[model samples]
Target: MRDKAKGDGTVKPKVYIAEPVPTFVENYLSEHCDYEKWEQNEKVPRDVLLEKIQDKDGLLNFGSAINEELLEAAPNLKVVSNISVGYDNFDLQAMAKHNVIGTNTPYVLDDTVADLVFALMLSAGRRVCELDSYVKNGEWNAEIGKEHFGLDVHHSTIGIIGMGRIGEAVAKRAKFGFDMDVLYYNRRRKEEAEQKFDATYCDLQTLLKQSDFIVLLTPLTDETYHLIGEKEFSFMKETAIFINASRGKTVDEEALIDALTEKKIFAAGIDTFTQEPIQKDNPLLSLQNVVTLPHIGSATLKTRQQMAMTAAENLVAALQGKTPPNIVRG
Candidate 1:
């Protein structure tokens, strides 16, 4: 509350948005604060994030890395708002140590991401991309035998790596939409698991071995970083479809490429990458079994609008000497 007025009593506080929010959020933002948005999809460089936010009380960031090194440049920063559900890009320990509040947009993206998870599962299960190419290349009439065949989802087994809000939504959809067996692997076993969708809890190794489709839904943490390595891939069934909609660093890309190239796994689908914009010479680019996306898990028009507005509200509230709606820390 130290720097509230922007030269006039009615003028709003200054809020720096590392990402450009949709038009829907502008009105809400104008109500409480004036915002500076980055015009492009590029991440704000660390020095720029610090320099621009040095005097600002709050910031609305999307995938901007706000580590201790970066935060040192912002002594006036009161709150950091992330438009994403995953805050791995931010350094929570540093923020907490510095007494800066951090918030994330979570519930809004849950369903959207769950939907994406199922979409990847279905695309892999049916060989959608491979066959689409075949048809486009006028090879549909050819003798595409069992080698090009796919699996049936109904009565099949599904394994989810994380059983959080998104995971639960995906489980419910799989249980009802395909009548599939749902097995979830998480740090802790949830109770609604059995009550809601009859989801069973199993160790990572067993889940990988049993699932016809393995979906990754966990956030990236030091402990979970590269949690899926070569050894983990070795435990999977050759026919198991691996779908990663979670943070890309959670998986070891080298092992994943080896698995796909060696036919260790049936197919793979990825909506995120260890590096964003996926480098021009990334190794996974050439794989026919992999389906890559530009991180569109929460890209629905309505969901994105809601997420932007929520993130704006969080910054406004926190900087106005109030608690944000979705505070990330305890």
Candidate 2:
């Protein structure tokens, strides 16, 4: 597809937006490109995106897979701008084969996602959601007893798997906000994090067995797929509360369900799942000791807008033959 010519005979990049963005983002895109957008509340259908992208130079979307099929459909495609930080949706091998650049919004949502992870941890540890329902459903006709008791967050030991930017934020909260002890396991040790948060670097097995709370924040990759499974779960203390604010596929869903069902762990707080908009029949939904959310770790209004803007800037920069700041390399 050829670039659209401006009235002054200059060519403007043609872009397609597969998801709705704030009016401000649209205005920004308008200043740099000739673009078309999906205006509906729901995500643009895959078929429609393939069709619309045929003549586009760049695409801005949330988590669409950028594989050979999509690349072949858009021969002129120069870049794919993902609104979220995780680029697992991108098939880097295929993108590189086609000489396409991929970018994601990072750093912008670290604090917001960290806030949700802590929210999940507190909700699960304190049984806030379960107890709230207990009172509203008239199940708490009298003062609650030991059976309704929940764990405490402050002063507990927290194990963070896959320490990164968000993990550092969580560590800061644990250390100062709650006076909790922090332990972390990552591909590489972060000395800065250890010094800043008084965090102890340890092996995965050690972290799992010793911490009162376990949080998974690893990015999903071939190596990290199902990083935590049955054996890993068995290592945790029976009183441990597990939280997953990262991609769902990083943990084996069936192993998690088994651990929860058999009381291997006290409870869990999950923001992402193996399957999104989780099926009603998923056993996790039926567990009283679990707190679930709809993958909204970075869903705050202000943060989301910033992410969109970052993605837009990346797309515009790549289309203009400049190096985008947040490129995802294979």
Candidate 3:
């Protein structure tokens, strides 16, 4: 029986990429494990997933939701490798209950995400997108109005929520590159933030009240869901700016639209939304003060490839019963 158990430990571990992983990522995974994909484009069918994942030794998943019900089906599953940095789509407590180790690729796209954050900040504050539209529609010389002038980002106060890796990176951009005072609110104090960015760690209320630009970088969790609603917006300066490169559900969409309509805030740059692909009739999209993106915070080719390779490497390591470099949830 001891010999059989040893053999079981050494047996070839099957690795599954729930979605079609990139070729380089596949090659990287192959360097360490026996791997195959489940789907080419869209998600593999639910029945197909339920049937195929039953005996998987390890799984690398994407946007697909993995809950307790799915975990129950995979008796041999030992690990989950998430392609994205955010793992809210995966049931962490349920995975822990099943003795399943889950890993996410964080920090790999830190700079890339920070770059996009600043890009949105500049575009929104300077009205870059709207100005470009004006030129495209032959209205370039018609912008001599009181409200057409853009806000000054330099010498402004930048408020950040969620002082995580991405949040810290955004601070560097605002404080260093744009010459802004960095104010942040986290669940706890970030001492290193003061040393690095000269950030003023304050209560959520203080940050909202003081900042000229509010940047959201928090992750999606129960505590953060709808974290920025009307009460928070009421405190923002009328000339203030807001940008969300974080999860969509973090902000109250209705409140944000109302803020834009009433001119409570000067402008906004939003990437993620309450619903992705933002329905055609979404009120926020109709607002002139808001600039929206298709949730491409880490969409640069170089960064995405690196994230995929990192996820693949972590999955391979977890499949072989080794400690993955970026394992989350303790």
Candidate 4:
């Protein structure tokens, strides 16, 4: 259904929201555009989104692929606003070919994601999830001994693979909260991070060998796909704890499974996976040393709401033919 015209008979821009958003964000979008939304909490089905986007001038979603097929289906589409910081789902070349602008919510979730990284680090290092299950299953009847002990995070060396805003947030926690020595590897050295967080910039191999905990926070790109595989794992210390809060494809799933199976690394905390809703038979699930999450890195209510609002603002700005604050350039 089309929205009623304004006082001057000017119709609002048409938009499709493929994911449910906060009421305030809906109200904000309503003020700027005529929108149809997928009301359910679940993601909009691809066919439904394609159909709904047929006449839309803007789209807002999280992790939906804005590829050739979708773009072809939406000849009127001018913008796609992603509610998450990562835009790997975007087919930048296709979007460009279709003359569509893309934007993402960044900075808002930096601290939130950094917190999850630390949670994963601590959970994997201390075997918190494993121990919790052991106690719940009545396996803790006997007094615990050294076998129940776990690695100490305080004063340990933490190597961060990405030195973006979220990585800096993690570094702050490592330095102030745990007094950890921070080492980092990035495409380009961040001098500010080095001085502020007392982080030492090193190559990937050096960081892998020296750090007690290695955290991967890099974005997924052609260059980063399977960046950490068997060869990279071989460089890590046997006592090292690996953490991935970035995209799943950034590390090789098979390689990670082998590393854990062979005890090449002591433990791992995985958030994003190569496949969402990870398959039942995936070997990662069977490993006691691995702590897996359903990719709730920026899932806090406040952060999600903020992201929704930011995305709404971006969609509105782009449709209005103004430059969006966070325009994503390939």
| Cα lDDT, all candidates | 0.87, 0.94, 0.85, 0.95
Worst 10 residues of 4 by lDDT: 1-10
Error of 2 at 192 (Å): 1.0
Model 3, span 127-170: residue lDDT tens: 98988888799886754686667888888899999899999998
Compute the lDDT of residue 36 as modeled in candidate 3.
58
Rank list by lDDT: 4, 2, 1, 3
- Model 3 per-residue lDDT at 235: 96
Off by over 4 Å in 4: none
- Per-prediction TM-score to the true structure, in the order listed: 0.94, 0.98, 0.91, 0.99
lDDT-superior candidate, 2 or 4: 4
lDDT of 4 by residue, 1-330 (tens): 946676778899999998999999999988888899999887788999999999999999898899999999999999999999999999999999989999999989999999999999999999999999999999998888888788999999999999999999999999999999999999999999999998999999999999999999999999999999999999999999999999999999999999999999999999999999899999999999999999999999999999999999999999989999999998
RMSD of each: 2.4, 1.3, 3.5, 0.8
Best of the two (2, 4) by TM-score: 4
Candidate 1 regions exceeding 4 Å error are: 1-11, 45-47
- Screening candidate 1 with a backbone cut-off below 3 angstroms (N, C-alpha, C), the clashing residue pairs are none
Residue 68 of model 3, lDDT score: 90
